[model samples]
Target: MSHSTAFASQADLAEKKTSFTQLSANAWAYTAEGDPNSGVIVGDDSVMVIDATATPVMAAALVRRIREVTDLPIRHVVLTHYHAVRVLGAAGFVPEGAVNVIASRATRDLIVERGAEDMASEIGRFPRLFQAQESIPGLTWPTLVFEKELTLHLGSLEVRLLHLGAGHTSGDSIAWIPSQGIVFSGDLVEFNAGVYTGDAHLAAWPDTLDRLAALQPQQLVPGRGPALRTPADSLSAIAYTRDWVQTLLQCARDGVAAGHTLQQVYADTRRVMDPVFGQVFIYEHCIPFDVSRAYDEARGIANPRIWTDVRDREMWAAIQS
Candidate 1:
């Protein structure tokens, strides 16, 4: 095997221009090209932010964008999952009276169990994403935890926080605004961008996507990529993610059944998926991790291994080299 860069993302230092688009009268999406996106919902008296950016400094810019549209206080910060890039920016919202950081019970547990290790691993893998790494106070824990679903009323607007099974992570959740037919799907759905299945439940992801599509959301703010404004776009995003996950897992399962090693499986899966998704954002950065997890699941590993900086390098070496 030939040695390659430990992580493809190590060289991804270029900055992306941010866009803040209003999806509805009250909901807005703050996206930076294909970087992790944040969703903001303005209510009668306050605001609720879904998925804080990677750092406090980065999140401050999101707050500034929100201020440009409304002066409402940012009262809530929601973590779609326990990923470091999404939750580490909770502190940035404190100055805006961010009283509640909400997440599913499983997300809270994952944070307690591996948040520190994940923080280090993610920062090392994608340094460009964590702009002000020092600004992250510590692990961002949730103030409120729910089992399956929790509904909140931001003034008169109703927001439904639901854990519709697992895909990107065991505790993946989405914010659904029923009245407006809008859903803020975390990493559970990505449009024309690579899906990071590093910690994903590959076998269960397709079903979770089915549930998300059944919502019939007219507008959706995905975890990455541009916001899906039309119902057709929303449905397309769900179908695209579903196909990606299913295809990857099928390749892994076929490789395992044929007794291929991890590296071979990775290569085979890449050959199948690259033509379809290689040009998508972060596709190269995510493939090694995605295929590794898919291979594990196909071989009967129900849970993903914890990723540290050391493990990330080892995995990359094993697969890439």
Candidate 2:
């Protein structure tokens, strides 16, 4: 698909995709203004939540929504990845012991290592979701961890959790509800927003998207965009995310080959990708960090380095200035 068919421009696609829309019966998506989003699927006997919002307080609001719709218990909480904003609010979803919190093994390892640093970094990025910060007891740990793929029957409702290769993060997973014909694509496929590539695998992103597309989902709740209602729309969203990763990878390499500084590389990426992404949610919030990571990866840096408190502040100061 041509870039424009998927997007009028990056800005137009980002804005339209980031806005959330309801998908189907008992299914809902909570998206940002082009920021990260979570999904929910309520079953007959229990509820399966796609992701926990940024804080306990934010998660409480979702629980309230669930109560308003159905008294059925929330049976499982699925973490798409190990991002602090996505998994931290799990404490708010203390809906009973029956609920199985599931994540990839790598996600569990991430929680052990850099979850705290990421928590601080994201809190500073998104203040609205992290309201009642003290309400967050600590990082959320998955009760049930899996490797690769798992077929979970949440009561009569059949849900599929697949670790369909890494695109967003090393441990990225997607929640697929075949009964509803809907898939929660986590950050593996960003609808309209610029993919936050700090923890992303740019080279593998396309194939990951292809694996997700092969699922033949009729409705899709992308990690950051609106719910995709049509096949064409879904393809477009996935394609755009792939294009974004490729664009940044090429731009970073080009800048480095020309002996440019990190800032210079970022500027070059912006010049080309901006026309397509200038309007996405957190475009400004994400670009410097995204560029830095991409630059490092393009220059042969494997296994992303830890971002400590000092490193976070230093990057924030340098990038923001």
Candidate 3:
């Protein structure tokens, strides 16, 4: 499409209405033109929402949707990862002491160390998502921390949260409701949305997908796309995410082996990935930084370097210019 045509297409997409996509009997997925995802799992007596979007105002809107679905008190708010957009709006679910917020231990550590900078970066990227910054007091800390896995019974419902290993982030968790056969694979499985492998473990992501596939979820709520209803759809989601991560990893490895600078690798990545994933959400804002981070990992760099505000501006200017 021409540039003007593409702009019109995006404008149409943005002007669409926001509604909940129900995958299974009581499982719900939320999609706005925003950061991260919000999932609502309604149980017997209460509801558990996964990933709180970006801020309170955004989350309040999600809450309104949940109220539309079921009147169950949102007893628990779960954090699938430590991203600012996902966890900061947790207060919108319930107050600190009243509701149990869950997250992986590594994610908790990441929030403490890099939370502020990440919050700043993501808000800068997706302004509409973080509707009211001042409404956010600070970072939302998880009240309950799990190492690898934890199972909880909310009244009569069974909710399983598993840390499948390092993939999208060091502390990614997949919430599975086996009885309902619905798995909330946050950011780990992208559908039409881009696979955002910035703080990712390139080599480990596939293994995590392998684990996700083994579970054979009948319904999947992906981080940023439409809900997957059948087993085929679920597997396809995981496969596409795996393929995207591996493609970037191999590209970065090849570029590094050829002694390419970060800029050269970024250019090559866009040259390659644009044909497949270039039109997804935040593709322009995310791809170059994703390439740079993957390049750093390919060069044997471990533990993502902290992305401070100044560093973000410097990186964006370097990549965009």
Which tens-of-lDDT digit does each residue in 46-103 have in candidate 1? 8999998899999999989999999988998999999999999999999887469999
Residue-level lDDT of model 2, residues 1-321, one tens digit each, is 111211112233232222334677767787766556888787667788889887888788778767777788877899999988788888888844466789999888888888888887767655555668888998898999999988977567788899988788889999888877788988888876768888877777788888888988788878886778887888888888888888988998898899888877876788898888887765665676788788888888876766655675576556444
* Whole-model alpha-carbon lDDT for candidate 2: 0.78
TM-score of each: 0.98, 0.89, 0.92
The CA root-mean-square deviation of candidate 2, after full C-alpha superposition on the true structure, stands at 5.7
lDDT of 1 at 132: 84
TM-score of 1: 0.98
Candidate 1 vs candidate 2, TM-score winner: 1
Model 1: lowest-lDDT 10 consecutive positions: 1-10
| Top candidate by TM-score | 1
* lDDT value, candidate 3, whole model: 0.81
In the predicted model 3, the residue pairs found to clash are none
Q: 73-110 in candidate 3: lDDT tens per residue? A: 88888899988878888877764236888999989999
lDDT sort, best first: 1, 3, 2
Q: Which sections of candidate 2 miss by over 4 Å?
A: 1-22, 95-97, 319-321
- For residue 267, give model 3's deviation from the true position in Å: 1.3
Any residue pairs clashing in model 2, and if so which?
10-276, 17-226, 75-99
By TM-score, the candidates rank as 1, 3, 2
RMSD of 3: 3.3
